[model samples]
Target: MSANAQMVAKYKNNFLKEVQEQVEMGEWVKMCMQCGVCSGSCPTNFHPGWEHPPQEIFMMIRAGKREEVLTSPSMWMCTSCYNCIVRCPRKLPITHIMHGLANYAHRLGMAPKMQPTRHFAKLFWNNCVKTGRVNELKLSMGLYFKDGFGQGIKNGMAMKDVALGLLKAKRLNPFEMLGGHKCKDQNGIHAMLKKARELEEKRKAIKAAA
Candidate 1:
């Protein structure tokens, strides 16, 4: 069975339990009282807007709408502004929960494939983790070309002035595309990241066994 399928069977399809055991800070999901303050406090809710706000997501988790909750783009909309956390009467770590849900959904391959936030996050993470330093030029290029080659050219044209300004200011380096400067101890950086992943997996396994 696929990893996701095995997880589903292991959890007996109890999504809330799965989240509690799997996601970071997910054990606090039950503290939500269905108050709409979190939704109201969200700036994205007024502008770009999400399908289901924090409270609604919690409700869905309780109701066991695993697929809907996991596949929705709502969690990816979180900007980590912490407005929800600041305003929540329960003092719940709402921001952490939202990010945790997004991370969990991503791990399960259930997040929206084309979600811009998710795409950008992946690009940024890969760009930084590889060398222990962000290649800003490559990161920008990746984002510009995320749509397509034609769109990428258009995007570049639109930002030509800004690019010129950055180049003149010496803040943006064209040669970094060849190979950016990385941490001195590249091997050590990779080892640390690998160890972190191993520790995380061990922690998750322990949680699951509990």
Candidate 2:
């Protein structure tokens, strides 16, 4: 058998199972026609570092390359320009699928080690969820210090000029970092986020029980 056929046969159960899971995760990916339009429209596909564009990612998903797909850097490269979606003959939500796959990978604890974007995204989300606003200084500190204090200092030094510029422009506050800034309706923000999380958990439970 050909290599493609061999892989499918070797992991037939996983292939079928993950295909069904992904179809349920992002329904539109199930309709991918392998037309390659999505990857062709994707500017990142030309970048040497980008290994799996939308079409290739879907194919990998179908082929049961679960670990590779989850660890792929390409998922984080989507620019959300919607070029693929606009051009897709199948009308697939290609951009959404990319984001979905990234989230799915992170949720499964399969994201590649030292994925800076993933770390940054989690830090950003946590800050936003806590205050209903992104405290730039806190977010930056969190991201930089995530690896450790030493790395944080190094990162801060690297961005010294940009940080100074922001400070000069009054875009960031040192005092807020210490005193902590918060939304006026902190209670309302907490309530809304709690409700959203509860709903998300409910959805996950339903999916798990299915």
Among all candidates shown, the one with the greatest lDDT: 1
User: What is the C-alpha lDDT profile of model 1 across 1-210, one tens digit per residue?
Assistant: 999976564333488898898998888998889888999999897545399999999988887888888888999989999999999999889899999899999998989998998999999899988988888888988999988999999999999999999999998887875675687887898999999999979988998999
What lDDT would each prediction earn against the true structure? 0.88, 0.77
Each prediction's RMSD to truth: 4.3, 4.2
Q: What is the TM-score of each candidate against the true structure?
A: 0.86, 0.77
Show the colliding residue pairs in model 1. Answer: none
Best by TM-score: 1
Give one digit per residue, the lDDT tens place, for model 2 in 47-89. Answer: 7557788888888777767667777888877778989899999
